[model samples]
Target: MSDRQAYSGMAVTGIDAKGRAAIPAFLRAALDRNGAESRVIIAESANAPCLIGFDPAYLEANRAKYGSRADARLDAGETVDANAARLAFALNDIASYDSSGRFVLPPFPAMKAGLDKTGPVLFAGLGDTFEIWNPELLEADAKVHPAFKERALFCLSQWKKGGKG
Candidate 1:
């Protein structure tokens, strides 16, 4: 909506024993359009049991928004919570992918997102950011939309049947 390249579509990919996963081609194209580098900030989603990935531009936009809000609160004689701001950025990990779109997920963020060390990872695009989900975790999440839950289940079934997720 703001002229930013939106992340769209969904893909299910495998994560190896060492937490390596490839960004799907569609999402990679969107990232390329938004940033000069093949790097993204992967963070635990505040509202879901999953990880969220966004390009540097998105992170900068968020930083600007946070700064403006903090300034406004200060102008209104309100205390700015420096610790809160620090925590928000501290939990994120910057991951750089190769030309093939392969990147290693940091152990902490991967665990926080409920991703298994080796399993299928579901990438769901949600406009500004995309979600990295452990298909099983996603299937078990009651808060996820019914359609997404169905999709996750379907992907898992396909993976179990020796099909690409």
Candidate 2:
């Protein structure tokens, strides 16, 4: 329910010959600052044609928020934690970073984004989460999705409206 720290601006890196893609140092630094270097979850969502990376902090935050919501409607006799667990596991297929700082992408994401044992991938900074996209796909998505423009305009309008006007 609260705003997460804004972490943006990153460059690209290639997956090594051995399929190890180094996450951006800046991004990694951000995660480290947030105490999220130990583990990270990589998954894919349809909204973006890229691999989505989530830190434990963000995931745990989400889990807690959803858990609280679930708790509000728990059966008096039944366990309140059950609903929380169910909601938490809904997006549980998260991949974690290895000792060498790499988490393999899920099959669906790897195939969809065409990420395999060769070439580079774009790692974008998305504040609370990070996205790994194929360069082509990232470009294509940018053209079609007006989210950035819309968000900019929305922010400008909000500023003009005097913070709540």
Best by the lDDT measure: 1
Off by over 4 Å in 2: 1-5, 73-103, 142-165
For model 2, residues 1-165, the per-residue Cα lDDT tens digits are 254454575455667665567666677766666667556666665476677776767877877887677666564444565654653555445565665566555665577667875665667677778777666565556553566434434433453554420
Candidate 2 lDDT: 0.63
Candidate 1 to truth, TM:
0.92
Writing each residue's lDDT as its tens digit, candidate 1 over 1-165 gives: 276788998878889887899998889999999973999899999898899999988888888999999999999999999887887788778999989788999888898887858888889899999999988788778899998788777876776787866
- What are the clashing pairs of model 1? none
Clashing pairs in model 2, backbone N/Cα/C closer than 3 A: none
